[model samples]
Target: MAAAAPALTRSRRPRLGALERRNLRWGLLFISPWLFGFLALSVFPILYTFFLSFTRYSGIRPPVIIGLTNYERIATDPLFWKSAYNTLFYTALAVPIGVLMAMILAVAMNQKLREVGIYRAILYLPSILPVFAISLIFIYLLNPAYGMVNALLGLAGLPSPNWLGDPTYARISLVLIAQLGAGQWALVFLAGLRGIPIELYESAEIDGAGAWTKFRRITLPLMTPVILYDIIIGLSLGLQVFTSAFILTGGGGGRGGGAGPDNALLTYVYYLYKQAFQFGQMGYAAALSVVLFVVSLVLAGAVFRWARGWVFYEAEDA
Candidate 1:
């Protein structure tokens, strides 16, 4: 009976007509350029990199098959460990802080003030600015001698440290740099905030809930999905932190160049860049890239798994 039912359902399904087939062909033709670009530019490079990770290639010479040597080298590489630690530490600090700042901005922007539009524009402006330009600005702002940061510290009689020059503060400085793009995530958070039903807040208020209570009980739960998204995105970007570090550390140049003092700013991607371009260890670099890809996938998967416990869907409740 079940088999007959399946067959009946399949038989009832309409077949594509000549006109439908022609439309499908036209649709495929329209998207062929993007399809080719994705295959040629994105998919092919990723597959090639994976293949190269298993071989010894110095770019000029033909690649030689060397199974796991690069990965083995990475296992024992002190710089690899250092870069990994730095990347993780940066992500751990930056993601949470960025998320918090973004949420704050979103809440503030969600207010019913007449100038809210102007305020939002002003706040989001920094997120759109080029990272290179922002890094350059930070270079001057964090200058220990005469920078604005130090000048402000001096006014408050606080100690001023060489933000980029000192290893102890270099990573911290980069974490601070990561906050500049919080406005981008703030926009995502704003959308989530807007999507929350106003009725919930009204009901909370009628139940004698204050702002904090309403936020904690109503806003927070509803916003978990957006928060999860921001965290995943923040983690991905933070793990690949390179531009600001590279720029702040003078393009990783000088005596122990490419890594800031005591290798404080030696992010994983920066180290990979150094190996692939600066040192010409293409095979090792490819291996590093593969590891990063795996790590990113694992982290994203873990976040999604964790989110299942807390992420709320209005449709699910409905």
Candidate 2:
């Protein structure tokens, strides 16, 4: 009886006709371009870099096997430690601030303010500005002596800090530059805020929930999923932060010398860049990138695990 049932089950797994099978094959063939690109550009480079990490491979020379040397160098290097520290600080400061600002702006903009579309466009325009252009503009705005920042400060008789020129102010300058993109993040959060049913807020209002109570009990809880998404994105973007620092600090190799005046802006990716291109340490750069990936993975995993308790879902009752 068991053998007969097994035979019956085998026949019930409906097979595709020749035309269907042919179509499937053709579909795979059509997607071969994507598959090839993934393999070549993404997969292969990652694997090759992983292997390269254990060797001493300058850009022009063949990789010479040197087990653990690169990792050891990374561990012992003072500059590496400084860059990592600065990167973490930037991440800590920027992510939360950006998240909060985006949420606030989104909520305000959602309030049916006059010509709201115009406001949205104006706010979003900063996010789309070219990095170079923004950097150039910021260059003048933050000019230590003649810049608007200092000029405003000087009006109040406060000491002016060299933004790009001083170590203490350089990392903060980078963080400020990063917040320019917060509008884009704000837009994403705005969409999420809009996704929340107006009925929920109305119900809270009818129930005698004050504005703060409504926000605490209803809005924050419902917004968690979106917050988690933005948090991950901000974290990743924070880690991969390179271009702004690169353009601002003069590309880690130029007359600027170290990142800004005192290595304040040498984030992880920037360091990897300096290693690969500036020092021609391709293999080592690859290893550093892998370490960066692992760190991001751990951080993201932590956020995901923590999000579950805090994140609310409308389907909980369902």
* Top lDDT hit: 1
Candidate 1 per-residue lDDT over residues 92-187, each given as its tens digit = 999999999999999988998899888788888888999988999999999888799999998999998988889869999989887888888889
What TM-score does each of the candidates earn? 0.91, 0.89
Candidate 1: regions farther than 4 A off: 1-15, 254-258, 316-318
Clashing residue pairs for model 1: 252-258
lDDT of 2 by residue, 157-182 (tens): 99999898887688898889888888
TM-score attained by model 1: 0.91
Question: Model 1 Cα displacement at 120 (Å)?
Answer: 1.3
RMSD of each: 3.9, 4.6
Residue 213 CA error for candidate 2 (Å)?
1.4
- The alpha-carbon deviation from the true structure for residue 108 of candidate 1, after best TM-score superposition, in angstroms, is 1.8
